[model samples]
Target: MTWKDKLGLVHIYTGNGKGKTTAAFGLAVRMLGSGGKVAIVQFMKAPKAYGEQKKIEECGALIESFGLPKFVHGKPTEEDIEAAKRALARAKELASSGEWDLVIVDEVCVALGFNMLDVGEVRELIKSKAPHTELVLTGRYCPEELFELADYVTEMREIKHPYQRGVIARRGVEY
Candidate 1:
């Protein structure tokens, strides 16, 4: 029996800070190192040049992006909502496929917070996940209800950040 046969749990990473995606990616790396297949579904984040994305691909993991070209701040456009829905649907498909050992839903909370997706849909997706597939959800503004559904939840609190000092995100560091 493989390690995948012995484990499958829901993990949530959320808060008004950094490291949510980083933490999830770290876990993905660990899983990949253990001979497990990993799939990442990014919501609300468009396809772009990201260091981790390249590394994850090189590590033999799949990464799918469902987002617009720019970030949604004030109000999300119809295209944004459609993209988020597609992301959620793809996440559900991957989580239930039983082919992947781990499935990471990146920026899902942000999509939910932007009203592009529904909490119930996410809950259903979690509930319907394959028994042998571990799931990870990451993003800011996580709903309280999700805490009750998740097996483990980590909240990243931002005490300080370089963005606060007018420093823009650097390449390969904060992409």
Candidate 2:
């Protein structure tokens, strides 16, 4: 369905790529340009030194980082799971009330892949979101259930990345 035709749409941007969260942010910008309210919940990223968080504030969107720096790769701690649950609950609250037109859960797939958040719970949250709200899920290895629930799915395959080389993540480009 067209974006206009879908009041509540689920989008999955998954795979081993660099632009999953970037794609979600692009959609948030699009929705914001259309005068849609947006809220972003970052699951895997810590609040320490994220450049997008600053840019999002400049763009007039609410962003909440609900992650600790304790998790490593696909392994998460018990505290990380708790944080994910609380963050997902907060996102659901915002989505259910219809205050925002778009809600983005960034790196949620990684959280699920690491068993930090329940896939069933996330699916239910998306299914139960307000009709006027759109939800975007972004991260690598999105769950099959989430993929099935999505109205649109875009996978970004990494042919090559600068990280493969000795190139460090520079400011504004990598962060």
Candidate 3:
């Protein structure tokens, strides 16, 4: 039997702090090392020069980003909505296809908070996942209803951050 035959659970990483994606990627690396298939659907983030992208690709995991290059602050534009919808659709397909052992929806909570995707749709996606396919959702502003549905929920609380001193995101560190 393959690793996919084992039990799979829903995991949510959410908070106002950093490391949600980092934690999820860490697990992805672990799962990949065990010869499991992983698919990451990144929402609100286009492909960039992040070091993790290269490493994840090299490790044989599929990673797809759906978003414009710019950051959305106030109101998301039509393009942002379209990209988020596409990302959700891709995530749903991956979760139920039985091709991947683990599916990560990166920054999906942020997409929901931005009103780019519906919470009910996300809930339905989670419910529709294959019984053996692990599902991971990462980002800030996770809805309370989702928390109730998750088997594991971790909140990364920021006690201190370099950004408070006007430090910008560093390559291979923050990205």
How does each model score on TM-score? Answer: 0.97, 0.91, 0.96
Give each model's whole-structure lDDT. 0.92, 0.84, 0.92
Q: Which candidate, 2 or 3, has the higher TM-score? A: 3
Q: What's the CA error at residue 105 for candidate 2, in Å?
A: 0.6
Report the Cα lDDT for residue 56, model 1: 91
Ranking by TM-score: 1, 3, 2
For every candidate, C-alpha RMSD to the true structure in Å: 1.0, 2.4, 1.1
Clashing pairs in 3: none
Candidate 1 runs further than 4 Å off = none
| Residue 45 lDDT in candidate 2 | 79
C-alpha lDDT of candidate 3 relative to the true structure: 0.92
**Per-residue lDDT of model 3, residues 73-131, tens digit only:** 89999989999999999999999998888999999999999989889999998998988
The lowest-lDDT stretch of 10 consecutive residues in candidate 2 is 69-78
What count of clashes does model 1 give? 0
